[model samples]
Target: MASFKEEVYEHISAVYQTAADEIKNGLSLIKEVWPLIFLLFLALAVLIWFAKPAPPDKVLMATGTGGSYKVLGEKYKAYFEKRGIDLKLVETHGSKENLQHLIDRKDPIQAAFVQGGMIAVDNLSGVQSLGSVDYEPVWIFYRKNTFNEGIHVSDRDIAKLRINIGPIGSGTHAQAVSILKQNHLTPTAPNLLSMNNADAVNAIEQGEIDAVFLVDGYESPNVQRLIKNPNIRLVTFSRADAYTRLLPYFEELGVPMGGFDLGKNIPDHPIQLISTTTNLLIDDRLHPAIQVLFLEAAKEINGAKSYFSKAGEFPVYMNTEAPLSNEAKFFYEKGTPTLMKYLPFWLAEFLERMFFLLLPFAAFAYPIIKSIPSYRTNLAKKQINSIYKDLDKFEQNTIQTFDPNRRGEYIEVLNDMERRVLASKAAKLATADCYSLRNNIEFIRNALEKQVIYKGR
Candidate 1:
């Protein structure tokens, strides 16, 4: 007769074999759900790719001119350099040249400081304006006699005088040419000279030039000097209403005399001036992150309290050459960008990009995550049900196999199987199952002992 230990070892081996078979069967069933598994992996990959690191290297900025933009650009370049961004400063004639550079494929300029009234999108293509930075008032500084005297000249009289409108490629030149023509002055008859704003101002001071037109910011040093000058006078646009009505590109502004200095009492009365705003232009294809960064920079740079402007008066988006970019539009309507203002620039850019990429997966992923626990529970129940099948088979066979010699071996094997299954401790099985299994094992053990003693008798 076999020992109890030897018998129990065989039964325990069989139970483990059965458990392996059930595990294989479960895997086969799950194989049918390959499509869902594949989708889960795909979603994971997309999340990783979208949220993956953004460019950590360098950012590019475009700067133009010898004026305020150049000054502001220099400051930003220095600031960003310390933060590790590589700044690219480009020199152009003025705002008009800057806009053309952005639109031109040959030029790689990403952004520009574009003066107002210089762009006609009807002619140019593939460029957009972020928003206006500040105003460039059209300064019509003239010789002493031109405005002080009646200077009544018909279209015929305008043809007789000498005028230095602006440099050929400048934004001032574009608007000056239009206004002069509207007033019935021909370009050739006035002996129009193409001179820069500084040179024109100098000539007006010396009486070398009859009239000079400047379309530049009020904070410009040349403008300040002209404002304080008693000999030279700014040409007052008495027909401010007519100018605004006819020139849709222009807005009427008042240069309060002595506005520069209330103590000095410069101009006793206000001087009517024609003004237009300078816009921050970008290529239509420029990255959205760049657009957001620039708007953030402009908010701080343009709106500061200065000699010419009231606080919060600049960086306006209402009138622009091109429509505001989506990022810029969001900023204007909403109070402030939580992510951009609070987070690092590259980090904010990453979050913005990730939002767009993850939108499709959210609906599917949320439900899967919620149902995970129930799926795991079903798996546990299935494993316990497999153990129950083996238990039922052993119960049916125990009664039929009733030989005296083999009885001890059979009882020992059944006892071992019961011990293993009970040790598995499946939560799905009731507490009563432990009592029933223990009783059945004891009954088999007692019966086998009784048969052995009967055979000996």
Candidate 2:
């Protein structure tokens, strides 16, 4: 018999009442779990504080003034630039200077290409290795006219000749000193000269120097230029095995006949050379993400086949004077991280940090989450008990007063108490207790009504 407007109004009222009840319940639930919520936020804040910050946007690497090291650095720079990072190449004299830069705590250099045998493994403290990238052959080029044809080059012959052993801080200089000392020759020999790669190459070409000791990759411009030069001759290490025995870091490499130029039959016979590994070293404090990026760049750029290396043969763990980095070890063991393979570098790094951050938090939060339900139930019970205490006081007052004239007022008070209890959010959770309370209120009301009837009679 209700009109449409009346029905609509009633429906709207019911909807509003339901919404209000839900909001009240939600607020009550939040109150019960507020401590847990606070704890979770605190834990998150701690994790974020301790988590490794995002990788630096700009990184500086030490490379040689001009040679394969600089070229390799340029390649690495290109790789990093594609991933939204700036890789600045700092020009150094060579491996010794590069190693010194890495060892200096105040230096901004984070990475460098260090040759094997330059530093003793036991001496390294602040630097670590990504891996060996390639072979740096010790190319001893001499003017053919200086040494008779078919005459084996001897240490005495090299000791007497004017030779450019590279600049003071170069790997060529270091190795040249070591090799000369092993041959009972001193670095202070008047014939030994210190010169840069270009100057040294020019000296040898113009016949200013008898020979030059170059420690560089086969693909290096200076090495290639010397290889193609008709007047210059590469000295074959006849005692290569003996040298490798004395210098354990040196490896024997064989260059097949006509390897440099088949058409001209350059080096017409097979040659034996002693070489050391080109190690990629980084500062111990470098960020792990950046370390991983270096490893990946090594894989992409240095993993290819070259005259001295097979495809996928490089970026291998070898001749590392310093301990291998954790990131490098992980890379060699597991390959690139799965997320990095598919995601953008920055996004992958963010997700990786988030994953590490959340993993421990999940472990920490599991027990707390599991206890929430029990906590919520206990909170409801506590609220119900407080209401019961109020009811008990009211009932005790009613019993003690025993006023029949005010029995109607007591009934009204009981009705108000019932309405408040039913409206309580806790009442819904402890439904049995709520029903029992309502029943008790009704009983009190009935008792009051009966008392009033008896008194009236």
Candidate 3:
């Protein structure tokens, strides 16, 4: 016998070898099933790609003139870069054109800055709003004294003269027409001229037009420039509260006297303007990821106080004609998706997509895994039972036949069964199954030996 230490080492080595063999066999089984695994994941990938698909690498945004939306577009471009996506800003005339771009099938526009009250939810069924971002205050700049040069006049007197109500396909134009119509001054009444912003500015400066209408923020470069000019007077409504009631979407805002330039005392008195919000709207066709991305970007850029809004007062779900986007609604309800809060954007998106896929995948795969052992064991049982059936037939034949030659044949069949049983045990039948085969073989041998079949029947 080997020494105790040597014997202990041998036992440990044997155990290790057995473990290694088992591990090798497991790997071999996995290798054999690789195609199945590949097909499963491939199917899952297809489902996820189709169902909760990842957003494209690029998106399109529609922004309007006067450097207001241009600044917002640039901010979104930088914001999307951190998430490894590109934001392409397409310039348009104004809100009406922006909405036109968003709703058009040929246009790849995903998001836009649209004015409130322009679209009714019933009319523009394909578009959705994220939230109202900021005030696009309807600014009416005109030659202050042109109505009665060297004399005094009133609002109606100024209204009778020609005015630039903005180009036809513009947000300013839409609101201007509506407001003018409210005052019963139709844009088509020949007193209103449809001119672009630059043209409108020129028209007013040169006395070609009495007034120019613009829908923009108080801080808009054009608004600021016009505020500083002596000839161009900002339109102030003393009856702002009454106008707000007349147009529900309009907010009554007071522009303090000389707010633009305290030193110059530009206004000389407070100006009240009726303003409507500019909403970030998305077409129903845009991906949800881009929708959420735009919402987040809008919050950071537009949520701060301008001359009108308080801090965190913007990007609000203002009562509107268009319905809100799903992602925007969720963002308002739940803040942010939980996974996205901790992980990088792309990774979080990937994992979120996979979670949706894997839930269904797991449901599909569970039954197949659960049935595997039963299927294999039944196959092995059939092999053993086949030999058992042969044994039963041999014994019956012996009883019916009296020939000695046939009896020798019966013994030979038993020998063949014994060999088959030993081979099955060696091949990897379960311990209990192998023992059952051996016991059955022994029982048959006893039958043969005990003259269950004899030369003299």
Candidate 2 wrongly placed segments (more than 4 Å) = 1-32, 121-123, 152-156, 370-373, 393-420, 441-457
For residue 293, model 2's alpha carbon misses the true position, in angstroms, by: 2.5
lDDT string, candidate 3, 365-427, tens digits? 777667556545565677778777877787677678746556567667788987886776223
How would you encode candidate 1's per-residue C-alpha lDDT over 407-427 as one tens digit per residue? 657777777766665765343
Model 3 deviation from the true structure expressed as Cα RMSD, one decimal place:
5.0
For model 3, the superposed segments whose C-alpha errors exceed 4 Å read 1-24, 27-50, 105-107, 147-157, 359-379, 386-429, 445-451, 454-457
| Candidate 2 structure quality by residue, lDDT tens digits, 1-457 | 9999999999999999999999998887678799998898899899989998889999999988778998899999999999999999998888988898988889999999999998674456889999899999999999989988777564446778899998887789999999998988889888999998899999999999999999999889999999999999888888989999999889899888888889998887888899998999999999999999998899889998889889899899888468898988999999999999999999999999989999999999999889888887777788778767887898778777667678779888889888988887667677887888789878878878777434533
lDDT on C-alpha atoms for all candidate structures: 0.68, 0.88, 0.77
TM-score (all chains, Cα) for each model: 0.66, 0.85, 0.82
Candidate 1, clashing residue pairs? 257-267, 258-266, 258-267
lDDT of 3: 0.77
**Candidate 2, after superposition: displacement of residue 318 in Å?**
1.4
Give the CA lDDT, 0 to 100, for residue 192 in model 1: 82
Please give me the total number of clashing residue pairs in predicted model 2.
0
